[model samples]
Target chain A: MAFLEVASITKQFGNQLVLDQLDFSLEKKQILAVLGRSGCGKTTLLKILAGLVSPDRGSVRVEGQPIQERPLPERGVLYLYQEALLFPHLTVEENLGYGLKVRKQPKPQIALQTERMLYDLELSAHARQLPSQLSGGQRQRVALGRALLVQPRLLLLDEPFGALDPETRSNMQLFFKKIAQQYQITAIFVTHDLKEAVNMGQQWALMEKGQLTHYQQLKDFSKDPKTGLQQEIAFWKKIDHQL
Target chain B: MKSSNLLSIGLVGGFLLAILFLAVGSLATEWRFPALLPERYTFEHWEAWFQKKAWMYYLVLSLLLSAAVSITAVCLGLMTASGLSRDKRSFLWLRLSYLPYGLSPVLYAYSMQFFYHISGLAGTWLGVYLAQLILVYPFAVVLFFTYFDSSMHHLEDQAGSLGASRAVVFQSITLPILRRPVQTILIQLFLVSWFDYGITSVIGSGQLKTLTLIVYQYIGESNLIYSSLASCILMAPPMILWLLQPSRSTKQDIPV
Candidate 1:
């Protein structure tokens, strides 16, 4: 059995069906990039997995144990939004230590772990600054470090880099990859950018109308017309030929 | 001076001049219309009122009533606004919150007087309080509703996901974030209750003699000195609130 199993998840908002019999599974330490356009239930899927929204009908298992009925924090799933929602009142050190503080960790452990996270995020120089004082990339790094310090079983990222400029986005993506590797994080990265899905994910899936199609290989994802990879390659090739 | 600077000085000068006029009016022995200052100034009115202790009585009563109304309204309003922010029927509820303000306060009090009379609350301090609350509670709700927006809810969710319990989230995140807005709304609602006349007159039934009602009494009797004294006293709390308010640069934010 896979490390995480999600089966027959369905959700509806009013008369509109948002998720229709979604099914997928992930191995330990694998990153699944879910590619979809706007209004394709990508956010809903992540929210469901994170236990923020209840699935109308579904079962989710993490490490052979059911988690859908569990309370949000107990579910060990953290969902990151497009914005870097650092607690505005908190300093960088305090924000990084928030997860540990909430868990009622001993003060010494919290200080040690928070220091480590601040160092890892390269934010020690600005530890006393509030969120408003930080740059966009710095804030997002703080947010990511805060989440990683919690050591959640799964991280659900919903277009986390969508608000960043292209240069910042590329840097964040690389930084995320480095951290995910260093920490062996299991994540489902959701994005509308096909290239992001191809580059960031070890496993791949495409979602349309609440239905998800899993791709077992890179070539399979590339060949799938729904992913727009062929069109992307052709366009890049034309630009290359012109140049 | 620049026109803008002149305008600012003019406004402050005008306000101070008005307060001085009231102070002189409260102390005048006899002042004719043409006189710039009082013909003869005396402390008799202030002395006589202090001896009777009537001013103290009304001052304490008004303070207690407005404090109770404002504190209760702010607490209840915060909870109601938080719930309403997530509710689908929020627009309808917010619309209803504005309904009480649509009518004149006196007319609104008259409309609700029957319920107070039947409940045996009319002509009591409680009746006047409930009456003012009818006006101020909804005002508080409307003011606080905008403070609980999508971003605020998102932060609460983020806190919950970070393993903070509901109580922890409220204590650590919600209350701290709401501190400034709560303070502002508390002062606003207090002033609303402090200066209320129409509703208090109708529901208090001449029995609840708050400072505002006493000031109106002096005015009705054409006792200008006592009226001025009471009016000056009535203005003190709000003026203090204004003076105590933080400057814009130093003011802490509330809503995310």
Candidate 2:
């Protein structure tokens, strides 16, 4: 059985249906990138998985246990947003250490882990700075560090690098992949960018108007005409030739 | 001059005029209608006002009442706003929350007189406090509702996902984020209650004397010197608070 199972999730707002009988599953340490246009229920799906929103009907199961009714802490899920959203009141070090502090980890361990994360993210010098003091990329790095320190069962990224410039976005994407692989973190990242989805996810899915279509491999995702990945690749190639 | 410059000058000019009036009114020993200026000035009224032990009591009473009402109103408002912002169904009640603020405080106090009488709260400190709270807490509610926007909800969700209990989320995330706005709102509510005359008189039934009531009484009795002295005393706290407030540029640093 899949390690994380999302079964028949349905959500509606007023007369409009946002998610319709959505079902999917992921194995241990697998990253599933979901690509969708705006208002395609991508955020709604992530919220449901994070337990921020309750589905109209359906359930989520992890390791054969139902987590749909469980509170947030018990679910062990973290959702990272496009905005860095570092707590303005906290320093970079404190923001990174937040989850550990909340989990009541030993002070020394928390300090050691946070310090290591600061160094790894190249934010050691700016550890004492507030969120407002940091550049957009640095803030996002701190947010990622915060999520990782908690050792969540699953990490959900909702276009986490969308706000960054191209260079910063590329750097963050590579850094994310490296850390996720090293830690063997199970994740589902949502993005509108086709290249980002192909680069990050082992399994891919396309969401359109609340329905999800799963692709087993990158080859299938790129080859599928309905997804327009092939056409997109050709357009980029044409630009490359002109350049 | 730019409109902003004009507005600033107007505000400063108004404040200076008020101060000038207070000084002239308090110091003048006698003034005939034919003169623009007072004929004679004396410090005796100020000295006499300061020497009166009862004036101190009135000042202390006003301070305590305003502080209590503002703090209580802010706490209650924060709770109400948090609940209302989180639940879509509760938003319908937000319009109703403004009803108390829409009515004049004296009228609202009059309407509550029957309830206060039955509860034996009429003419009591508790009665006056409740009356001010009804008038001011809604403003706090409205302010907090606007402060705690949709973006704030994301922070709450993020905290919860990080294994924080609800209380932990509030203390660690929400409260800290809200501190500046809360402080601003608290001072505003305090000033609202501090300057109040009608609600206090109506609710306290002219029994509980505050600095405002004293100022009103002196003004009505044509005790202009005493009234101006009391007015000076009454205006001091809010002036200090305004001076101490964060500057406009720094205000943008606050999230909401």
Candidate 3:
């Protein structure tokens, strides 16, 4: 059984059917990148998996149980929006401790965990500062720290690097890839940049108009002699060049 | 920059003139504020205000209504803004609540009287509070919603994901973030409650005598000096706080 599975998930936003019987699954300690053109249901699918939205039909299961049945901030599901969504009123330590505070964890424990997160994510020096004080890259790093401090079982990132400049974004992506491996945390990331999806994800799922049309290993996509995959790779290579 | 400053000066100057005219009329009896220092000034009228116990009652009345209106208006504004921030179903209703706020308060009072009369709420303390809530909650909602819908919306969602329960999210994130706007609305509401006579006279039914109510009543008695002093006292707190507020949204890096 997979660690997470979104099976036949269907969703509609008013008149538009966003996700149509989409199915995908992932293993533990794997990074799954969801790639799609704009207006596809990549975000919708990520939100559904994160339990931020409910699917119209079908279910998202984690470790063989449906995630929908679980309560918020439970089942260790976290969604990192395209924007960092840092709490404007909280400092770095306070933001990291937000989840711990909500869960009623002990103060010493929260302090310990926040310290670990700050040092681990290279955010210790910026801990006293607010989100607005930090540079774009620094803020995103704090956002990651906040998310990681929650000790979430599954991390759902909705273009977490969406706002940074190309140089910053490229560096952060490599930094994040390293962190994701070191922590051995399962993650689903959505992005328009195919190079990011290709290089970062162990598994890549292509979404087209809400449907998960393709799911394959990155090795398979890169190594397949198929002309279709080759063209897709080439197209993203051009984009990567421009970026 | 200079033009805006001049406009502000002019606006203050115009108000000073009107007040000066009123004061001049009052000082023909006793009140005074001359170009520099008054050659002659008497507070026999001011002493008379303290000597009158009715003034004390009017102070209490004004204080009660201001407290009632400001607290309830702000609370309702916060809750409604929070509800509107998340729930889109009542967007039209939320938008419509603000419509009357743009209309003249006199017109609103003119329209509100019939309902108060029918409901037997006329001339009641409850009636004044309700009227102020109706008048001010919309302003509060507008200000609060605008703040919420901005980048603050993202913080709200992130707070939810961060293990804050819906209630926790409200108290921990929403309320704290809203301090600046809520404070702004609070001062504005205090002024509105202190000076509002349209609904006060219409709904007050000659019984719910607030400071403004008594001021106008003093004017009706041809005691303009007495009323001027009374109005000045009534306006003090809001006047003080308005000057005290941080002039702009205190800007620094958003501490998240």
Candidate 4:
């Protein structure tokens, strides 16, 4: 059985269909990148999977257990937004410790883990700084550290790096890849950038009009003409010939 | 920058001058026209006022009423705004909240008095509290509405997904995010209830005597010293509230 399975998820907001009969599955410790344009219902799918929103029809099972009916905290799923939504009032250390604190973990254990995360995020020197005091890249790192500290069963990322500059985004992508491998994180990464999907995810998919098409291999994703990879490559080749 | 600094200093100077005038007027026995200062400054008025002890009772009553009204209004407003902000009909509901402000407080109180009378709450402390709440609750809701934007909602959802339960999210995320706004609204609403006389007089029907009512009564009786004393008393709590306000720099990053 798959580690996470979503079947026939359908949602509508009045006359507008936001998500329609969406289906996907993820194996343990595998990252699935879903590429889509804005208004393609990628966010809605992530929200539903995170249990932040309810679907009119579908079931989500994590580890063979139905999580659709579970409360947000009990579902063991964490959703990260495009912006680094850190608690402005909390210091870096405090934000990193928030999840464990809410879980009623021991104070010493929280302190120990939060300290470790701060070091891992390379934000130990900024342990006392508020979110507003940090740079964009630093803030995003803290956000990721906070989510990972909770050790959620599934992580839903909704274009978390989309707000950063290109250089920072590239660095963050590498950072995420490193941490994801180290922690064996099972996650669904949603983004609009096709190159990002190919770089960041082992499994790839494309979403359009609330419908999803999955590709099991990089070659398959590249071969899919709808991806426009051929056109981009041909344009680059023509430029190379002109040069 | 320089002009703004001078303006701030001028405002503070004006406030201090007003307080000094009130303090001197409260103590003066007789001060004729054109006198720069009172000829005879005595503690006679203060002694008499303290001895009568009526002001103490009115002071406590005013404190209790304002505290109850502001606290209840803020709590209700926060909850209502949270739910209303996410609703499709939020704009309509918020527009309705402003209806009370269209009618003057006195007129609104008089209009609402019938229900109080029929419910047997008129002329009681509860009656006055409820009347002030009616005027203040909607104002609180309007003030708090801006704080519940999409980003705030996203923060709450993120907190929830981070293994915080609803209660935990409220305590940890929502309340902290709302701290500055809540403080601002609480103080503003408290002052609204504190200095209120129109709604109280109309609703209480001369049975309840808040500090504002007593100050007006002293003025009507042509008792300048007593009125000045009452005015000074009335301004004390709000001044203390001002002093207790959090520093501007400390709240620089209050989350929307």
Candidate 5:
């Protein structure tokens, strides 16, 4: 059975249908990148998976067990926002230790794990600094580290690097890809950037006007003229030819 | 003059005048009209006021009342504001929360007099506390409603999805992020309750004697020295709280 299965999800806001019978599934430790424009229900889909929002009609199963009406804590899903929403009052170390502490892990174990995460995220030097003291890239790293430390069964990213500068965004993308592989994490990354989706995801999906179109491979995604990758490639190719 | 410059000057002028009055009124042993300066200066009035057991009782009572009111209001406000912020359907009733704050406290007290009489809370300390709570909790709600932005809701949802229970989410995420704003609201509510006169007077019915009432009585009796001493006592805690406020540098880094 697939690690995660989402079937026939439908949602509406008043008279506006925001999600229309969307269906997808993922294998264990696989990453799916969802590409879409604004108001295309990509975020809504992620929220539904994270248990932050409910679908009007759908069944989400993890490990073949239905997750419908399950509480967030029981669902074991986490969502990362576009902006790094670190706890401003806590130091980086405290932020990293929050999940373990909440889980009632032993003090020494929590400290050890937090220390390892800090080193892994290259945030050891910023252990005592508040979120405001960290740079944008550093803050995002801390947020990612905090989420990863929780060891959720499924992680959902909503343009997690959308606010970073180009250099920082690229660096974070590479870092995410590396850590996700190292930890064998299952995630669904949502982005408006086509390159970002192609770079991070093994499979790709496009959402438009509350409908989703899934592609099994990069070639399949690029070949579909309706997905807009073909037009983007043609435009770049024309520019190269002129040069 | 630029408005900012005018505002600065006005604030400084007001502060200086307050200090001058407090100093003169608390120290002057004799100062007849037409004299720019006091004929004599002494700290006897302040010393005597501080020594009185009645003054201490009133001060402690005032502190306890303010603390109780602030704590209750903030707790209620946090719950109400969080619910209202998460659900747009509750917004229609949000304006109703402001009704208590918008109306005069004395008028509100009059309207609740029948309930107070029947409940036997009309002239007790509990009655005064409840009255002040009714007056200040609405402000607390408004403050928290405005203070908590949409990002906070996102953070809350994220925490919940991270396997944190509702209590854990509140303790680890909501409370930590809202520490500064909550502190600010508590202090504001404390000050409002500490300085309240109308509702306290009407509800207490001469039974509960808080510092404000004592000060008012002193002023009414034309006793400037005792009134000034009471005013100094009233201002001490808030002044200390203001001095202990987090620096601008520390405040700059709060996550949006």
Candidate 6:
């Protein structure tokens, strides 16, 4: 059985069918990158998996148990938005320590874990600084640390690197892969950038009009700029037109 | 820390000036230069009311009722705001709900009396409270909706991913972040409720009389000393809360 099972989940917003019994199953500690154009409900799917939204039909199961009656936090699902969602009132240390604080972990363990996360993410010195004081890369690192601090089984990333420039984006992407490796956490990252989808995960799923139309191993997909991803590129172009 | 901020502070001073001018004619009863200060500092008039045995209870009841109304209204407002924040359009409904504040308090109170009376709430603590709730709930909703809507979108999601139950998320994410706004709303609702004579006079007339209504009674009787002393006494609780407030971190936040 898959560690996380999303079986034919259906969601609708008014008369529009946002998701039509979308079925997806994934292994534990594996990375799945969801690639889709704007308004295709990639974010919405992640939200459903995170238990942030109640689906109109179908169900999600974790570890083979139905999650119908469960709340999002109990499912150990974390979502990272495209923009950093750090609390403006908190310092970087406190922002990263928030999940730890919520779990009511002892102060010392929080300190040790935060220190290690800061070091791993190269955010040690800026611990006392506020989020407004950090650069884009630093802010994203703090966000990652916050997600990892809880030791969540699933981390739902919603295009968290969207705000960074190319240089920072690539750097944060590599850093994300490293943390994902170190923690061996399951991550479902949503992005429209094809390069990000390919680079961040072993598997890639294509979403269109709130439906999952394609799924593949990243290595199986070709990356040649001239001919590669032509179908996806064209599919997104049409979707953009519709949007 | 902007020029607009300085302008707002200047406006608070201007409000105090307006209040002072409201009573300037009392000073005109005797000659006073510039008519800014009262003709004579006479405490015996309003102070005599304070000296009465029953007067303090009005102050006590007003404080208790307003505080309760502020807290209950805030919780209700928070629920509505958090629920409504999921959609962008729900804000229009929330904003439109504030039409009560735009109406004359006396008319609103009289109109609402039937609802309270039929429910067996009038002349009862809960009745008077619900009356104030109706009048002030919009303010609570407006204040907390602004505070919670923008920030809470991602908050509950994050909390849930951490093994927190729905109740846990509500407790952990919604409540902590709410401290600052709750403190602010508490003071504002208290001030609004404490000074509100229309609803008080209607719902709490004999069952309870707040310092505000009593002060108004003396002012109508042309009893300046009684009105002034009662007004001063009535203003004390909110004044103390405002003063004791900022030292607490939650009370000191800039609206941003």
lDDT per prediction? 0.89, 0.88, 0.79, 0.90, 0.85, 0.77
All candidates: interface RMSD: 2.3, 2.3, 2.8, 2.2, 1.8, 3.9
lDDT of 1 by residue, A88-176 (tens): 78889998889899999999999999999888898899999998888788889998999999999999999988888899999999999
Which stretches of model 3 miss by more than 4 angstroms?
A214-216, A223-229, A232-243, B15-40, B99-120, B249-256
Off by over 4 Å in 6: A104-107, A213-216, A223-243, B1-51, B84-96, B99-103, B111-126, B236-256
With a 3 Å backbone cut-off (N, CA, C), the pairs that clash in candidate 5 are none
What DockQ, on C-alphas, does every prediction get? 0.54, 0.62, 0.56, 0.63, 0.62, 0.36
The best candidate in terms of lDDT = 4
RMSD of each: 2.3, 2.2, 3.7, 2.2, 2.7, 5.8
TM-score of each: 0.94, 0.94, 0.89, 0.94, 0.91, 0.81
Best by DockQ: 4
For model 1 the local lDDT of residue B113 reads 89
Predictions ranked by DockQ, top down? 4, 2, 5, 3, 1, 6
Model 4 lDDT, residue A27, Cα: 94
How would the docking of model 2 be graded? medium
**Residue range A42-157, candidate 3, lDDT tens digits:** 88887788777888899888899887987776767888877777777788888888888898999999999999988888888988877777778887888887888777888998
Q: If both were scored by TM-score, which would come out higher, candidate 3 or candidate 5?
A: 5
Q: Number of clashes in every candidate structure?
A: 0, 0, 3, 0, 0, 6
| Candidate 1, position A213, lDDT | 96
Over the true interface, candidate 2 deviates by an RMSD, in Å, of 2.3
Across residues B1-256, which tens digit of lDDT does each residue of candidate 5 receive? 9999999999989987997787788899877688887889998887787677788888889999999999999999998888887776666657888777666888888888889889999889899999899888878887888655677777777667666788888887788667777887788888899889988888888888999998899899988777877887888888877776654312223464
Q: Compare candidates 3 and 4 on TM-score and give the better one.
A: 4
Question: How accurate locally is residue A232 in candidate 5, as Cα lDDT from 0 to 100?
Answer: 90
Question: Per-residue lDDT for B148-210 in model 2, tens only?
Answer: 677788888788898889899989988877877888888889999999988898879888999
The parts of candidate 1 lying over 4 Å away from their true place are A238-243, B1-3, B34-36, B249-256
Residue A137 in candidate 2, Cα distance off native in Å: 2.1
Q: Given the true complex, what DockQ would model 4 score?
A: 0.63
Count of clashes in candidate 4: 0
Per-residue lDDT for B91-116 in model 1, tens only? Answer: 89989989887899999999998999
